[model samples]
Target: MASALQYIEETIICAEILRLMPRFLALLLRALIKRCLRSHEAIYVTLLPVADQRCLERDTRNLGHDLPKHADCIQWIMESSSRKAPWSGKRVVHELMAIWFGSVHALTTTVTFAIHDLCLHPEYTEPLRAELEAQYIQFLKSGRGLPLLDSFIKDSSRLTLVESSILLSLSAK
Candidate 1:
């Protein structure tokens, strides 16, 4: 299981299509799409066995070995209000993809964009660092965040969002 997972980890999320000369880029995009899809499906196929095992004993629906300890998100999702079942292995795998995108993907992408933007706009670096140092002291004193840092983070996130992505921005007080 570990070796198989290691192999999957080693698989590149996308092939080197961007490096191809301009003319070939268009042609290779389709191949890149296919490769990504296959990689995605490979993960689903890998998890089918575990999902099947978890679904087998619905009465005791405890996916983890440790009793009363918090189980992993996959187990929680299976038990969540939306998923009542006699769960098929395929359904479990599909749900895995859904849960991952909503939580893991969103968080990683948000952090990635935030970090990338920080690199792109070096002017804000010192100010943000100083703000964070000040904020840490303030937090220890009163557990409150300063408006300047909050607004900056919110605005940075808002600006970094892609055109096609939907984001509802709530003003930070």
Candidate 2:
């Protein structure tokens, strides 16, 4: 269980790092280039056009197959683009990247902080651990049917979010 938690923490941190990489690179570019290269602008001008083309081609190829629906950003881009006056691939890519970064950061932060809170409040630890064990397989299969785990995560997230807001307020002074 300890190992599992450690693994999860490491995975979340790694994912968070990966999710921020574009912004980090853009910051580096802004620093080195001596100009304000916003991350989205940098990404749009550099790589997203190619990705958008690839995504469009793939979706076109899979039009008849029973594939999962497109991601929201990609779907919107496809809807907006046409034979003429096409949507900018950069915008599509930027929106997708933004969503990825935001979702990963929010989820990882919530989970990490909640785990920290669980550590501090040891009384809830055993019950939570037991609940996790019981629900682990089910969660793996259906990603649901874990009310206890959900409640624990929500409670932990709430407490940690409140604490973080307080800390942020203090530090801003």
Candidate 3:
């Protein structure tokens, strides 16, 4: 969604597509979007059984030397996969694409719905904002906790689950 947000803001077409997509009769449109993104990535890493492991190695080298240490899902995947088996670049890329697709969609939907609810219920906003701000400062200073923010996120995710009825109807079609 963050990536989509960039395009959505820069282009009316992307914004309109996003607005119209949810009302589509089926999830084919969303699936197409995911496939399109996947195909683009596949050009770099065929995600085939024979994909070169050197890409992951180069990325790791770049991470340590060229780029600053950063916490990222792909990095975690590389590290964890290396600890287990002979690193398969294809498997890592495949898993990374799947994880990215699931995370982007779920998080974007969750955050959007949460913000919409917060806007509708202004009464809860102030308290949440206050708690987040206070905890954010402490977090920046000590890096210890963010209990209220964490709870709010958990509640938001619980409240805004994609309706199973919608999924059922789509699948029936």
lDDT of each: 0.55, 0.55, 0.54
- Per-residue lDDT of 120 in model 3: 75
- Candidate 1 structure quality by residue, lDDT tens digits, 46-129: 788877766665535446444343487657756763454456766767767555444544555567667787788888788888
RMSD to true structure for each model, in Å = 8.4, 10.8, 8.7
- Looking at model 1, the pairs that clash are none
Identify the superior model by lDDT, candidate 1 or candidate 3: 1
TM-scores for every predicted model: 0.55, 0.46, 0.45
What candidate 3 gets wrong by more than 4 Å, as runs, is 1-50, 53-79, 82-89, 102-110, 133-135, 162-173
Off by over 4 Å in 2: 1-41, 48-86, 138-142, 159-173
State candidate 3's TM-score.
0.45
Q: Return whichever of 1 and 2 wins on TM-score.
A: 1
lDDT of 2 by residue, 103-162 (tens): 545676777777887788888888878888888898889978778668888887765433
Model 3, residue 29: C-alpha shift (Å): 9.4
**Cα lDDT for residue 129, model 2?**
82
